[model samples]
Target: MEVRRRDPCQSVQNFSSSSAPYHTIFVFLIPLLVGVIEINNVQNRSKSLIETHLMSMCLFLLAILIYAFAYFAAMKSELQVFKAIEMISGSLCSVSLVSIILPRPYGHFSFIIWAFVLLLVAYKESFHMKIWQFWNRFGGNNQQLLPTKCVVGCPAYP
Candidate 1:
């Protein structure tokens, strides 16, 4: 008997089934990894600060773009919800990028802006409400931590 290959959709299903845990880990790790890579690139003298930063920004943006497309293709039915998350995350990333791209006075605030962007990135990809809930625990319903429409397609929402 010949062995058969597993269906690709099955793998996608498995990956999407418990995306929160992975998203939580990835959200915390990607920025650290990007920082490390940027430091190493600078130390190696492989690229100037501007070059490395631009490269890093492009890579991060590409990652977001790829994930959005793949997620849409995989889920195939949550277009509206995905669009909302995309808008939120994309806007945050754009603001952070702008802060860094502009001249000194504004660039000085890049780190703070980028930090928020990273958090929003995590929220968009993971839809991990626990992170949001953790921050909002002092008051308000955790149920309302994110807009209902923003989480409509999220596995964690239900």
Candidate 2:
């Protein structure tokens, strides 16, 4: 009688390839459906600015939770890239959420400013450029792209 053992690397490769499709649907499609439902609910309701901001923050938290779950559940080495993207997304969400503490005008303006910063970061990452290089290419001088202190310094509404 002869005994044989399966190759460990082969088993891992097979598992990852087989599970990729299921992970794709779980990590991508489910969150997309959640987003659609959230948008629909928001549109159908008459919420105040604070309520809307809270809802937005909740959504971002939900997304981060989903991605975190996916990151842990994923077996493929390639799926690790989600971690970096997830962190960036969280930072962008936090930036917008910070505006909720400020007065109405400043809060709204801060949201716009942070959204632009998010765009800049996305552009820089997509083009594989350093942040300073991105600023240089886009004609920004000395990296003072926007007055971010306004968000921190603005007084809260009474």
Candidate 3:
């Protein structure tokens, strides 16, 4: 059966109202907070090593955050988490690529790694997803590989 799509606004409203995976949220956000805080020190006598480390950590944290949000949002909402992962992966890949292409930086590898993680998240979500073919376009019947064929050959072939 074809599922009706819910309004985006309503979906977000419902997600926020429900309880999500708190531990998952905390794990990523805390690192992000710390990394952003560390970046603040760059204002005075900024060193390349410090900048590079902070940038890499922040990029990793942001990637983790994206995956966490999708994973948790799925816990409360009826929305397909795979779709969210796919969208996020595509976005992350683009961002990572742009960062690598323009203005060479020491943290180029870090951005690329984020893109890789996004891909892994997408793959994991897809593999775990139980696609209800019966409730989907499959009409709840056994999926046919090719149109029905005779054991040997069809009458028309003979």
Candidate 4:
């Protein structure tokens, strides 16, 4: 297989039982939330809300990147799979941003789109169980159907 890392995880502890959500949020999400709050604070102070919001959005993108990087480092995941997932998710998200939930970045080009995709991948990995994990657990592919090469009574084809 053309891959770099192993499956999801040997144990669920890898995702959920880190015992320190505070640390995770502190190191990653808090700065992001704070930057947003700062933009609000700026708006409250009668400064340019648009400019602050833009800057806050940029900061949020940075925070997402930071969190994705941290998740990659901590999770011992395959970079190849992560890259593929990020690319596909980014494309799909852009489509949704364009077609349905049109966000600002969809209207305008922004790295925020990619950063959102990275966040999505990171958040998904936090679930611990993977597609392969579920499939294997459920014995999903036990039966196989083969096409018959012969219509009536060809021994070799049958």
Give the poorly placed runs of model 3, Cα more than 4 Å off. Answer: 1-19, 26-32, 39-77, 81-106, 126-158
Candidate 4, 1-158: lDDT as tens digits: 68764322333334432222323334554445445555546646765434535544454455456545545544455444543443343333333223222344553444456557557756897543464355435543322332223344555333
Candidate 4: count the clashes.
0
Least accurate 10 contiguous residues by lDDT in model 4: 93-102
Which lDDT value does model 3 have at 57? 42
Model 3: pairs clashing at backbone N, Cα or C within 3 Å: 1-135
Give candidate 1's total backbone clashes: 0
Best by TM-score: 2
When sorted by TM-score, best at the front, the candidate numbers are 2, 3, 1, 4
lDDT computed for candidate 4 = 0.43
Off by over 4 Å in 2: 1-53, 70-76, 125-158
lDDT of 3 by residue, 8-119 (tens): 4455444433322333334445555455544654575556433645554454447556755765665566675543663463345344433433355633765666668667
Q: Select the stronger candidate by lDDT from 2 and 4.
A: 2
TM-score of 4: 0.25
Residue-level lDDT for 14 in candidate 1:
41
Candidate 2 lDDT over 1-158, as tens digits, reads 89876544454453433333334334554455456546656755677544656755665577567556545544444564564445444444454444444555785677578667767756676543463355445543422533323343345211
- The model with the greater TM-score, 2 or 4, is 2
Query: In model 1, where do residues sit more than 4 Å from their true spots?
Result: 1-56, 63-75, 79-84, 114-158
